[model samples]
Target: LKVTIAQIDIPCSFGPAYEGERVRGKDLFVQAGGGKTQCTEYLELADMKEIDDGKVTVIGPDIPDMKRGEVFPLGIFVQVGGREFQKDFEPILERQTHHLVNYIQGVMHAGQRDIAWVRISDAAVDKGFTLKDLGVVLHAKLHQDFSAILDKIQVTIYTKKEDVDKLTAKARAAYKYRDERVDKMTDDDVETFYSCTLCQSFAPNHVCTVSPERTGLCGAYNWMDCKAAYQINPTGPNQPIEKGECLDPKLGQWKGVNEFVSKASRGAVTHYNFYSLVQDPMTTCGCCEAIAAMLPGCNGVMTVHREYTGETPCGMKFTTLAGVMGGGASSPGFVGHSKYNITQRKFLVGDGGLLRMVWMPKSLKEEIRERLLKRGAEMGCPDLIDRIADETVGVTEEEIMPFLKEKKHPALDMEPIVG
Candidate 1:
C-alpha cells in the first residue's frame, strides 16, 4: 500500500517527513531566495522534439563557491516533453519541486512559482552536494513521480544574478498566464471535479474534492493540479468525480460530492457544504495551511494561517483550532483552506462570504493583501482591507467589536454566523 518515489544517488538522507523540517541560521550552509535576493522556479510543457533528455545545465558557479550562510538568487527552469503532455499540467508538475527538493536530506524547500526558498545544510556540503546534484534529484524524482506523461525532462539552474534576473521575468510571465487560466474558470463551469486522497496517507479517512473555487486543504492541489494528476494516474490518489446533481447552489452541496465523500471517507462523512463554515462544512485532513473559525458574537468569521502562532479573535490559537478541525471529521463553525482560496468567489458564500472575515494575523493579512484588495473592490468595499482587523488591532471578540464598529466593518451588520 505504500508508494515510493524512485531512488536517486544523493549524499544526504531523504524522506516525506523531512519536507516539514526547517533550516535556520546556525545550521544553514546556503540559501536561495527567502527574501535575501530574487529566486524563481518554473516548469513548462514543450514539444517532445524540443527536449534534450537527461540534460542538466548550471549557468554559473556551483555549490562549492557559495559562501557559508550566504543567500543568493536562483532560477530553476524545467522543460519536459511527452506525446501526452498538456500545458495545464505545467503548474502541476512545477509544484512538485518543493516536495521533491525537500525529500533530499540536508535540504529544505518552501514557497512556489516565482518565490521559492531553499537551504542546504553544512553536512550536505561536506558530503559533496552540488548544484548539478540538485538537478539530478529533481530529474530522477520527476521521472519517478510522473512517468505516465513525462517522456523527457531537462533542468537548467541559474546562479548568477544576471542569469537569474533574466530567467525570472520569463518565469513570472508563465506563472501569470497560469493564474489567469484558473481565474476564468469557476466551480459551476466544470461538470467534473477531482478528488485528492494524497493526504489519506496521513489522514486515513480524509478525502478532498477539489473544485475550481475550493482547493484542497493542504493548499498544494488545486482543481487543475488534480485534473492533471487524474489524467496522469486515473487509479492514483487524484480521481475524477462527476457532479451528479446540484442540491444547493448557494451552499455548494451536490449529490455527487456527498456520495463520493460517503464512499471515500469509508462512510465517516456523508454530507458536505462546500461554501458554508457552520453547516455541514467539508471535513479536512491535518495538513491544511489555514483554519477559518466563526466569531458568533461579531456575526463574522476569523481565519488564521497555519504558520501564524498567535491567538485569533475567536478565542483559539491556530494549533488549538487545527486539533478540532482536521482528522477527516466535519466540524460546524470551523473550516480549513488555502490562503489563495480566501480571494475566491465562493469563499464562505453561505455565510456572507469574505465580508464575514473580521480578523486574521497581521502577517497572514499582509501575505494576501493584494488579492484581498481586489476582492474588496469587487465587493464594493474599496476600503475593506483597512476595515479588517489583524493581531495589531485586537485578539478577542470583545476587544474587536469596538474596532469593527469604528471602521464600519461589513461583518458587523451581516446576518448572524450562528443559528
Candidate 2:
C-alpha cells in the first residue's frame, strides 16, 4: 500500500471553503439528476489485481459537448481496491462524495445514490472542467484522506443516458443489499446509536442519530456504516452515543441522545423525537432522500422523494419543501428521512406508521410498491399501496379524500392525525 498523496490535478480551485457556495440558475452550465435527469453514484471494493490505481474513464460527452441549461444523465462509479479494504468500508468511502464534490469552487452536489443532483457552473466550464475531473477529484482526495485504508482508486463516469440508467438499476440493487443489513435489528436491540455529523458542513447544526433502523437522512450512512467509519477514524464525524434512560418510548427520545444533540448542535437544538413527525422531529438537511409532511385535511401524512418534481398532497413541491426545512431546523409536522425508513417498523409508529401514509408521488410509490405491499400485510392493510393516492388521484387533500374514502384507505379510519 505505497500510495502517494498527490495534489488534486484539476483546473479549478478546490477546498472546503467553496462547499457552501451554490450555483444559481444564472451560472448553471449543465446539471444532472435533481428530478430532471437520472443521476446515480456507487462505490464498491474491488480486488487489487483487477483494478488499476488513478485510472479514470468517461463513457460519453464531456462538458463542452452540451449547450448551456441542458440536463444530462450521470453515473459515478468508483472502485477502491486495497489489501485492508473490506466490503463494509465501501459506504464509508462512498459518502465522502457528497462533500468532496462540493469541495470544487463551482460545483454543487446534492442527494445521494440514484437521486444525486450535480451542477457545473459556467466558471468551472471556463476553467476546462470536464466529466473526468470528477473522477480526478475523487481519486486524489479519497486516497489522500483514507490512504491508511484506501490503496487504489478507479473512477468511471457515464454521461450516456442508457449507460446511466444501467448504472442506476445496478446501484439500486446494491443500495437495497446495504439497507437490509440491519433489517432484523431494532432500535431496542442496542443501547447506543451512532451519530453522523458528516452532513454538518451543509447543515451546520444538523446531527443524525443513526440507529439500527433509522439510516441517515441522506440515505447513505446507516448505523453499520457509521460503526465502521468510527473504527477507521475514531475522531471523525461518526461517534458512538450511549442511549440513556428512555424518556418516551413511543416518540423514541432518550436522555443521553438529548444531551448529545444539544452539544453536537451547539445548543441550536436541544431535543428531537425519532418516531414521531408530529412532535419535535429530527433536524432536516438539504439532501434528504425524501421529505414527509403532514396532510392536515387527510388525517395522515404524505412524503415526496427527491426524484419527483410534481406537486404533493401537502401543496408544496419537493423543492419548496426542501428549501423550507433543509436548513437543519427541527420543524414540527415535517421531517426528513431516508426512503428506506418509510417501511421500517418504527418509522413514525407513534404517528401511525405506514398506515398513515396517504399520498406519495406516483413514481416513488410504484418504485417501493413491493416493499409497501409486504409492510402493508404486516400492518393488516394488505392493499395499502393501492389505497394511497398519487398525483394522478390528485395533489390536494380535498381532491384525494373521495379517492381515499372510495378505496377504503386505512388512514381515513385511523385516529385523528392532529390532536
- Candidate whose lDDT is highest: 2
TM-score to true structure, per model = 0.78, 0.98
Per-residue lDDT of 1-419 in model 1, one digit per residue for the tens? 11234677777776686765667678899998855677788888877687787789998878888789688889998999877688888877887787788777788876666556789888789898887877788788888877767788889999999999988889867755654556768998999988887666446678889999997776667888888787777788788889789999998999998899889989988989999988989887666778899888888988998667777888888778877767778888899987778888899999899988898888877877888899999998977889988888889998888999999999878766776
Q: What stretches of model 1 exceed 4 Å from their correct place?
A: 1-7, 13-40, 46-52, 57-75, 102-131, 145-148, 158-173, 218-220, 285-289, 305-311, 315-331, 361-374, 377-380
> Once superposed on the true structure, which residue ranges of model 2 sit more than 4 Å away at CA?
none
**Cα error, candidate 1, residue 347 (Å):** 0.7
lDDT of each: 0.82, 0.91
Model 1: lowest-lDDT 10 consecutive positions: 1-10
